[model samples]
Target: MTILVVILALLVGLVGGVLGGQSRGRASRAVLDDSLQREAQAQAERVRSEAEAQGRELRAEALRVREEASRLYQEAEVRQGQAAQQREQAMADAARERADAERERADALRERGETVRERETLKQDRQDTKRERDELKREIERLNRRAEQLDARGEKLDAVEEKLEAHEKRLSEEGTALQERVRSAELKLYEVAALTPEQAKEQILSKLDSELEDEKAIRVRAMQERASADAKRHARHVIAQAIQRSASETSAALSVSVVPIPSDAMKGRIIGREGRNIRAFESLTGVDLIIDDTPEAVILSSFNPVRREVAKHVLEALVQDGRIHPSRIEEMVHKAQDDMKGFIHTQGEEAASSSGVLGVKPGLVQLLGRMYFRSSYGQNVLKHSVQVAHLTGIMAAELGLDVSLARRAGLMHDVGKSIDREIEGTHVDIGVSLGKRFGEPLEVIDAIAHHHDPENGETLYSVLVAAADAISAARPGARREELESYIKRLENLEHIAVSFPGVQSAYAVQAGREVRVLVQPDKVSDAQATLLAREIASRVEQDMEYPGQVQVTVVRESRAVEIAK
Candidate 1:
C-alpha cells in the first residue's frame, strides 16, 4: 500500500510539480512582464521627461529670442532717438546758418541799394550844379552888357547935365530981374507981408534936427550889420587858423614824484631806526608817508599845498644827502619849508609873465598862480583861467567892448579858491570880495559875482561875461568826474520807493528823474496807485539831488484764465 501510495503521490507530485513549474513559469513571466512594464514605464517616463525638457528648452530658447528681439528693438529705438536729436540739431544749425546767410544777403543788397541811391543823388546834384552854373553864366553876360550900356548913358547924361546947368543959371538971372521990377512996384502995398529971416531959419533948423534923429536909427542899424559881418569874418579866420595849428597836449604836473633806487637796501635807511625818520618827516612836514609796491619811492600826501611842497623838497634832499635819520629828516624839512615862500612868489611872477598879464597886484597874482596846484577836468585851473582870459579878450575886442576888463575878470574869477579852505563863504562871494579889495572896478566885480549868478547884473558887459563863463564850463569834456554816486542815488531812490508794503518792484529811470513802481494788483487798488505815485514823487523830491521835478509811474496788472476745448 505504501508503494502504491508513493507511486500515486509521485504522480501527484509530478503533476503538482508540473503545475508548480507552470505556475512558477507564469509567475516568472509575470515578474518579467512587471519588470518590462516598469522598465517601459521608466523609459516612457524618461521619454516624457525628455520631451518635457525639450519643450522647456524650446520655450527657454523662444523666450531668449524674444528677449534678444526686445533688446534689439530697444537699441533701434535709442539709435532712432539719437538720430532724431542729431537731425534736430543739424536742422537748427542749418536754419541758423540760412538765417545768417539771408541777413547778410539782405544787408549786402541794402548797402548796394544805398550806394546806388547815393550815386544817383550825386549825379542829380551835379546836374543841378551845372544848370545853376549855366544860369549864372547867362546872368553874368547880361550884367556885363548892362554895364557897358550904363557907361555910354553916363557920358551922354554928363553932357546934358552941363548944358542944363548953364541954361538954368541964365534963366535964373532973367527971372530975378523981372521979380525985382515987380517987387519994386508992389513994395508999397506988400512990404509989411514979408517975414523975418530968423523965423524961417528957426523952423528949418527944427526940421533938420528931427530928420537927423530919424537918420541916426538908420546909421545905428548899418553899424550893427557891418560889425556883425566883420566879427563873423574874423571869427572864421581865427577859428580856421587855430584848428589848423598843432596843439600841444599840456598835461598838468603831478604833485607827487617817484624816486627809483638801485637796490632794496635803501628802504631800511629811509625807514631809519625804530621808524624815527618816517616819523620825523610826518611830524615836521605833515605829509603821510606811503611806502608800498615801490622799489624805493615814498609817497607824500597832504591837503595843504604849501606843506606838500615842503615835504617833497625835504625827501629829495634827504635822499641826496645819504645821511637819512630822524634828526636829518627834521633838519632838511625845516630848511625846505623856509625856502618855499620865496619859491611861491617867484613861481607867481613867472606864471604872470608867461600869461602876458602884467601890472597885476603881486598878492593877487600869487593867489591866482596857486591855481596851478588845482585841476578841473584834467586841466590846470591856472592854465584854464589863462585860456579863458585870452578867449574873453578876443571876443571882447571883436564886439568893441572893454577887453582889459574882460581879461582881468576872467583871470580873477576863481581867485578865492586859493583861500577857500579858510573862508566861510561861497567861492563866488569870496572871489568878488577879493577882486574888489585888489582895486578892481565895479564892472569887473559885478562880472565876477554875476558870472554864476546872473540875476544881479545890469550891464550888457556883465551878461556877456556870464555867457562866456558858462560857455567855457559847459564845453565838451570840460568837467571832472561824472559821478558814479549818481547811480547809487538812483538805486536808493528805488529802494525807498519799494519799501512800501504793496509795491512789488521799483525802477529809477531817466537818471532818477523818474521812478516807475510796479504794484501788486490784489494789494493796491487803481486809486491807491495814483496816490502812491504822487507820494513817491513827493518823497523823491525831499531826498534827491535832482535838478528838475520827478515823474512817478505805478503799474498794476490782472490776469484772467480760461480753458478751451
Candidate 2:
C-alpha cells in the first residue's frame, strides 16, 4: 500500500505542472494581440490625415483654373466688341463711297444731256442761217437785175439827150443866121449904148458849173447805200456758227515718265554696283534713266513714248519686287513690252467704241491704240482723233451724208501721224498707204490722203473729215505752237497787212488771229476804205498760212483837227 500512494502523488504533481505552463502561454498570447491592434489604429489615423491634405490641394488648384478661365472670357469679349466696331466703321466707309460714285454718275449724265441739247440748238440755228443766206442771195440777184435795167434806161436817156442836143444845135445855127443881122444891128446899138458881149458869156459858164455839182451829190448817196446793204448780207456768221458748234478740251501730254521709289536708299539699289544695273536698264528699254537730285523719283525720257511707257512699267515692277539685276531687268522689260501691247489693244478697242466706229481691222485697231502714246503739239493723238470723229459725224448728219463713213475717215485721218516718225514719209502719204495695205475702200483711202488737201477731197465724206480736222486743230488751246513759230506767224501777218496800199501802219493783235491797219484819210475815201478792208483780207488769205481765220480791219479818219482853236 505505501508504494502505490507514492506513485499517485508523483502523477498528480506532473499534471499540475502541465496545467500551470498552459495558463502562462495563454496570457502571453493575449498581450501580443493587444499590441498588434494598437499598431493598426495608428496606421489608419496617418492614412486619413494624408487624404485630407490632398483634398485641400485639389480645391486650391481648381480655384486657380476657374479664375484663369474667367479672365480669358473677359478678354475674348473685349476683342469681340472691338471687331464688331471695326466692321461697322468699314461698312459706313463703303456706303459713303457708293453714294459718292452715284453722285458722280448722275452729274456725268446731266452734262451729257446738256451737251446733246446744245448740239441740237446749234443745228437748228445753222439751218435757219442757211435759209436766210439763200434769201439774201436772191435779193442780191434781184438788185443786180434792177441795176442792169437802170443802166439800159440810162443809155436810152443819153441817146435821147444827144438827139435833143443835135436838134438844138441846128436851131441855134438857124437862129445865129437870123441873129447875125440882128447882132450886127444890136452891136451897133450896144456900142452906142456903151455895153460889152464878154460879160454875158461869163454869166452862162457859172450857171453850168452849179448844175454839175448837183449831179455828183446824187451818185455818192446811191453807192454808199449799196455798199451798206452788201456788208449786212455777208456769210461771216455761218463760219462763226460752225466754230462755236464744235468746242473741245485742251490738255498737254509729255513724253516723259516719272517712277516713284520707296525711299532714297532704293536709288542706290537701282544704280547697283558701278551702275551696271542702270546701264542694263537703259540699254534694254532704249530710254534714258535720269537719276537726279530729286528725292525718291526717277525720270525716264525717250522720243518714243511707247519705249518710255514700257520702261516706266519695268521700273515700277522692279521697285516693287526689290530685285534689280541685268537678268531681272531683261525679264521685266520683255514682260512690260508684252503688257504694253495688250494695253494698246485694249485702248484701241475703247477708242473705237467711244468714237462710234465699227468693223476696224485688228491690225488697224492696234495701230490706232498705239496712237494713245503719241502726241501732236501737246495734244493726245487718240483724243484728237476721237474728237474729230465726233465732229465729223455731227457735220455729216447736217449735210445728209454717210455719218459712219465720215467718222471712220476722220478717226483714221491722223493715224499716219502716229507712225510718221517711224517711217520715212508724210503723214498723209503714210496714212494712204496704211489704208490701202489694210484693204480699205478706195473712198476711205482717198479721204485719208486728202484730209489736208480740201480741193483733192472728191467725196463729201472726205470733205467732212477735212472740216472736222480743221475744227479740232483750230479750236482754242487745242494745240501748242513753238515760241519762234508764233512770233514768226505774227510777223508774217503784219507784213502782209503793211504791203497793201493806203495802209499807214499795220498791227497784229488778238494772238495773231486778227490784224488792224491805219489808212491815210486823204488817200482812202469812206467808200475806198471799205474796199481796202476787203482787199486786205483777200491778200491775207492768199499770202498767209494761219489757223482759224484772221480779221482785217482798215481804219480811216478825217481828223479835221484845228486843236479846238
Candidate 3:
C-alpha cells in the first residue's frame, strides 16, 4: 500500500506542477493524498474482510472434519455392537441345537449330587463302567478330529483376514502418498499467492497459520494413533511396490551338481585305473563321483556345496586336460580349492554391487559369496538377499529414512543362512554376530536379528527389512519347502492342537495344509470351541513358518444311546 501511494503521489505532483500555481498545486496534492488514503483504507478493510471470511471457512472445515470423524466413530461402534449381538445370537442358537446332546451327557458328567443319589444303581452299573469308559475314550478321539477341522476352518478365515488387511493397507498407503502430493502442490500455490504485496499476504497467512496450529496438532495425534495400530500392515504396504518392481530369475535347483563329459569314454577316464584316480579326487574334495547311466552326464554328489563345487571344478579341469591319473587328480584338486576362493570372492563382490551396498568387510563379503551356493526352502540365499536389499531400500526411500543403511541391512539379513548348515545357532543369531563382527551399524544388526519378528525390532529399518524379507520369500516361485519340512510342519500342527486343553487328539491331513482337532464336548462349550480354534490358529501363525496357508479345524460331538432288554 505504501509503495502504491508513493508512485501515485509522484505522478500527481508532476501533473499539478505543470498545470497550476504553487497554491493550487498544493491544494490538489492534499485532495489527492486524502482520496488515496481513503481508498487505501477501504482496500485494507476489504482485504481484512476477505481474510476473516477465509478464516471462517477454515474453521467450518475443521468442524466438518471433526463431525465426520465423530460420525465414523459412532458408526464403527454401532457395527461392532451389532456384530457382538449377532455372535451372541449365533452362540445361543448353536447351544439350542446341541440341547439334546448336552442332556444325554448330563448323567455321565461329573456330578457329585447325581452320584450320591444313584449310589444304589451305581453298584449294579459297575459291571458296564469299563465299557462306558472305553466308549467315552473313543468318543473323545472322534471329537478331537472334529476340533482339528474347526481349527483348519479358522486358519482359512485368518488367511482371508490377512489378504483383506494387505489390501486395506495398500489403499491406506496410496491415500497417504496422495496426501503428500496434495500438500506439496498446496505449498507451491501458497508461494504463488504471496507474490503481490508479500507483506500483506504474509500478514494474512501468519494469522491463518496461527489459527491452523491447533487443528494441525489434532490431526497429527489422530494420524499417530492410526499409524501405531497398523504398523506391521503399513510396513508391508511400504514394500508392495518394491515387490512388483523386483525381477529375480534364480531358482532352487537340486543339490547334486551334475558334471557333463564329452562322451561315455570320458566317464571311464574319470573313474581312473581301478578307481585309484577317482578315489584320490573324492578323498581330497570329499565329493562322490557317480558315473551314472544318464547319457554323457556324470553326477557329483556331496552334502556340502563348497566341497561339491570344488570337486566339480577339479573333475572338469582333469577332463579338459585329458589327465585322470592319481597325481594329476591331486594337483587339479589343489588348484580348484584355490580357485574356489577367488570365485566366491567375485560372486560376493557381484552380490554387493547388485545390492548397491558398499564398504563391506572382506570376511562378510566371502560369507555373502557362500550364500550363492547356499539355499533354504529351495530358494537361492544370495539372490534372496539381493532382492531383499532392493525392497528394503525402496521402502526406506519411500519413508524418507536412511536408504543406504536399509539396503545394507537387507543385503546381510540372510548372511547367516550361508553358514547356518555348518553353524551351531539359528540363522538369526549367526546373522547378528556376523553383523557385529563386520562392524555394521546398530540398526543393521538389530534388523538382522529381528527381520523374522518385527514386533521385537527397535528401529523402523527392522520393520522395513522384515517386510522385504517376507516379500522375497513369499513371492511366486521364490522358495519351495522340502518334503521333510512339509511333513514336520504337519506334525507341529497336530502337536500344537493336541497340546491345548480339552483336545482329545489331533490329526494333520490334507498334505499338511489342514489339521483336524477333536475336543471333548463335555469340557469344551460350543462358544469356547470356536474361541479355541481361533486361538490355535493364532498360535500356529506365531509359532510356525510355512509357505502358503495352514487351516485348523475343531470338531465337538455328543451322542446318547438307549438299549431295551
Which candidate leads in lDDT? 3
Candidate 3 residue lDDT tens string, 25-129 = 766566576666566667666666666777788789999999999999999999999999999999999998799678767755757667776996877688589
Alpha-carbon RMSD to native, per candidate? 35.2, 33.5, 47.9
Which stretch of 10 consecutive residues in model 2 shows the poorest summed lDDT? 232-241
lDDT of 2 by residue, 349-415 (tens): 9989988999999999999999998888888899889988888887777667788887888789888
Ranking by TM-score: 2, 3, 1
Clashing pairs in 2: none
**Per-residue lDDT for 1-565 in model 1, tens only?**
3344454465556556655665768855654555655665575566566667777887899999999999999999999999999999999999999999999999999999999999999999999999999999999999999999999999999999999999999999999999998878666444464645576568779999999998998999979977985786575553323222212234444556555554667777877789988887788888787787776566777766667778878877877778988778877877886687667677667766654567888888778767767665556667666666666666666677887777777677767776787879977888888987888878778877887766778655566566555545433234444345666677888888998889999998865657889999999999999899878876875677543345788999988999999
- Estimate TM-scores for all models: 0.41, 0.47, 0.45
lDDT of 2 at 447: 80
Between candidates 1 and 3, the TM-score winner: 3
lDDT for model 1 comes to: 0.73
Number of the top TM-score candidate: 2
